[model samples]
Target: MRLSQSLIPTIKEVPSEAQIASHRLMLRAGLVRQTSAGIYAWLPAGLRLLNNIADIVREEQDAAGAQEVLMPTIQPATLWQESGRYEDYGKEMLRIKDRHERDMLYGPTNEEMITDLYRQSVKSYKELPQVAYQIQWKFRDEVRPRFGVMRGREFYMKDAYSFDIDYEGAFVTYRRMMLAYMRTFQRLGVKAIPMVADTGPIGGDLSHEFIILAPTGESQVFYDAAFEDVDYGAANFDSAKPDDLGRFFGIMTDNYAATEEKHDLDVWGKIDDSRKREGRGIEIGHIFYFGTKYSKAMNFAVTGPDGQKLFPEMGSYGIGVSRMAGALIEASHDEAGIIWPDSVAPFKAAILNLKQGDPTTDALCEDLYGKLRKVALYDDRSERAGVKFADADLMGHPWQIIIGPRGAANGLVELKRRATGEREELSLDAALAKIGLNAS
Candidate 1:
């Protein structure tokens, strides 16, 4: 991606409406633009990264044995009515009337719709443990939407549902989804703690909210230091097996963690002072085991082993995909700008031609850019070195390859690591190898 040829509208002045660092940086960096209250139009650069985040979510879900099926943003109102939540969902539900005067809505969540889909197809205990997921747009119609995408009305989300034969089956499915959430967050370049949470309108007795530490977070959380060192990738638990899931779930339940909404000082006091971690965190994902809540309300049932119809136990898990763009900024940014993690960065590195049009400099940058084009954003714009440097830092590419007439003539390039303010002058091939461009 060449900066001069691309639509990344990096700007100098911050927008007046942006209330938080993430919001300000997003606007100034030209990642997104507010079209209406809490509604944004994701720009090219932002859209790419947003899709990357969704891809990671999809991979984790698939690895955890969940199958992906896209659900529509708009759904029939009857689905909500069938689950007895039509009136209970409140104004956040974007209820609308179609041209035929039928009640419809931009779905806030898909519990009822998914239940309808499930009951219409599956009819026996033989297909009892199916998990379906979707990554799509959702609308909540927040009355006071603020903080950019953080509290947006229309946003991207990944919601997954599990249908199982009974409570025990549902619990195992829930644990698998929870494990997926933990791995997803870790890969998204943030450490998140699973804290006990209120299910609210979702109506679940067992729930966990994955909260990421950020100074600007809305909710306060407390957790044991044990969460800091868990090797999620090394868990080696199979999602399909109940015993494996039960063991994993037990490990999570044994951890001391709770959000302010469900905090307990009695239990909190028991943890060693050195191991107690108290801080504010952003809710990045949530998982819940809501046994038969929707299935029973919607009168859905599958044939049991004994030939009787029984409501399947179920659960729902959610991750805020669009909000994560803002959340990632909140959790990882420094004074300069975004400092994106490699796994979700729009481009792995930015190749800055410090002296654009200089024969030697331009040639060196062009060669390097060609070699790294698949994972690099080439800054070929005719801007000052300072302007290019500032914009590169602001956009937060993991690395910046600085090329100038002096360095180009010497057959060397400056490699700058964005996360740490580390720079090294190295031979062109050495620089390429250091940035993983020519690594064997």
Candidate 2:
């Protein structure tokens, strides 16, 4: 993509309303714009990152045997009433009325609606273990939405609903999701620790909140330091039998980890000082096993092996897809701007034309840009060298390749890594190779 031809509306000064670094940087970098108090319109650059994150979530969900489905944003309130949660969900639910005066709402979550869907078609044990997921927009009228997308009233989320015949089946499904979440976060370059959490309005005894530690995070969390080094990918879930999965679950559950809402001072104090660690963390993902909560209320029943009708056990898993954009910025950024992870960066590298009018520099940048179509952003704008340098850093591409008349004359280009602030002078082919692109 060429900067001169793109719609990147970067600003020089931070917006006064942005209170956090990620919020400010996002505004200054032209990633997003606030349309209302907590609603935002994602610009082209921000949309690229959002799509990348959603793709990762989708991949992991599919790998875990979940089918993708789209659900409506506006749903009839009758569904919530059927589940007995219409009055219990409280004010955050955006209640509305259609022209005919029917109660309606923009769904804050989809438990009630998904239950109704399952009950309508899935009537037997043949479809006992099935998971359906969707990536869609959700709205919750947060009284005070702040921290940019991290706490936005309108945001994108990936929610998956699982149905099973009984507790044992539910456990199997939950373990599959746990393994999936680990892979999802790992692929996105985040170390998310799963801590026991209060289920809150969702109402469940078994729940885990995946948190990423950041200084600006909202909740306090406690866990063993050893969890920081544990890699879920090392455990092969694809080949693991039921017994192997049970053992994996035992290993994860045996560890001590809990959010502040569920923390026990006495139990936490039992751990040695070296093993204990406390920090502020952002909740990026949450999973819960609410057995028969929605199914029973909505009459979602299936025949058991013994020929008895039973309400299927249910569970829900959620990952904050839009909020992860801000969370990624919060967890990884420097004074200059965001330091995007390679997997989600909008562009792998920015090709800076230090002297746009110079024939040599122009030719070099154009050649490199043509060779690397999707992986590079060519800065062909007629701006000063310093201005281009600053914009490249602020945009947070993983690498920046600077070409000038002097460098081009000497058969060299300046290559810089955004995260490490390291620069090197190398031949054009050498620089492209270093950025993991084939110059040929």
Candidate 3:
């Protein structure tokens, strides 16, 4: 993508309304624009970043045997009414009336709707365990929505529901989802610690909130450093195996981790002093094992093996897809701008043409750009070297391929890593190799 041809409307001055680093950086870097209070229109670059995050979530869910399904943003109020939560959900539920004067709402969550879907088609213990998921937009009428996408009124979310025949089966699904969430967060280039959490309105006795540590995060958290040692890719546990999940679950819960609301000093005091980890954290994902809360309330049931009617135990898992964009920025940014994780960066690298039209410089950049055009953002604009540099840093591509006339003429390019501010001059082939490209 050429800068001159793209629609990135970067700003030099920070908007006064943006109170957080992610909010200010998002606007200044031209990732998104506010269309209304607590609502935003994601620009091309922002959309790419969002898609990348969603893709990771989808891949992990599929690996965990969760089938993807698209649910409607607008839901019938009857679903909530049947679940006995219509009046209980409060103002956050955007209740409305359609042309026929039927009560409807913009869904904040899909528990009731998913329960209705489950009971409609799934009829016996033969299909006991079914995990369905969707990545879609959700709306909640927050009274004071702020902090950019962090607390947005309308945002993208990935919600999954698991249906099982009994408590034992549901607990297994919950552990499996926990493992999936850990893998998902690690892949998204963030370490999220799972802490015991309240179920709140979702009504679950067992719940866990996945939080990523950041100075600007809303909740103060304390945990053991043992969480930092587990490598998701190398962790030898199978999501499909019950015993493996049980072992994994034990490992996760054995560690003392909690938000301020759930913090227990007695437990915290027992941890080794060297292993203590404490910081403010942002909640990126949550999982709940509500058993028969929705199924019982909505009177959804299937025939058991003994030919008796049985309410299927269920669990809910959610990840804030759009809010992750802000969370990622909050967790990983420097004074210059956002330091995007390589996995979710809009572009792999920026091709900054220090001398845009210089014959030698342009030749080198075009050659590199042509080879990596699919993954590269070419700064083809007729802007000053300093201006190009500033914008490149602001956008926070993982790498910057700087091609000045002096370096280009000598068949060399300066490669810089965004996170470390490290730069090196190398041959064109070496530069490409360093960026994980091979000369074909």
RMSD of each: 1.6, 1.6, 1.4
Query: Candidate 2, residues 1-440: lDDT per residue as tens digits?
Result: 89999888899998899999889989999899999999999998999999999999999899889999999999999999998889999999999999999999999999998898888889789877999999999999999999899889999999999999889999889988987898898889887888887788888789988998877778888888767666666666677466756555665577788878888999998999999988888899999999999888888889888889999999999999999999989889888888999999989999999998899888888888999868888999999999998998898999999999999888899999999999999998888778788968
Which candidate number has the best lDDT?
Answer: 3
**Given candidate 2, what's the lDDT at residue 372?**
84
Best by TM-score: 3
| lDDT accuracy of residue 53 in candidate 2 | 97
Q: Global CA lDDT of candidate 2, please?
A: 0.89
Task: Tell me the tens digit of each residue's lDDT in model 1 across 1-440.
Answer: 89999989988887889899999999988899989999999998999899999999999999888999988888999888888889999999999999999999999999998999999999999997999999999999899999999999999999999999988788778877888888888899898898888888888798888899998888889998878866676555554555755555666778899888788999998889999998889988888899998999999999999999999999999999999999999998988898999999998999999888899999988887877887899999999999999999999999999999999999988999999989999997888778777722
Q: How close is candidate 2 to the true structure, as a TM-score?
A: 0.96
> Where in model 3 is the C-alpha error above 4 Å?
236-247
Deviating ranges (above 4 Å) for candidate 2? 242-251
lDDT of each: 0.89, 0.89, 0.91
For model 3 the TM-score comes to 0.97
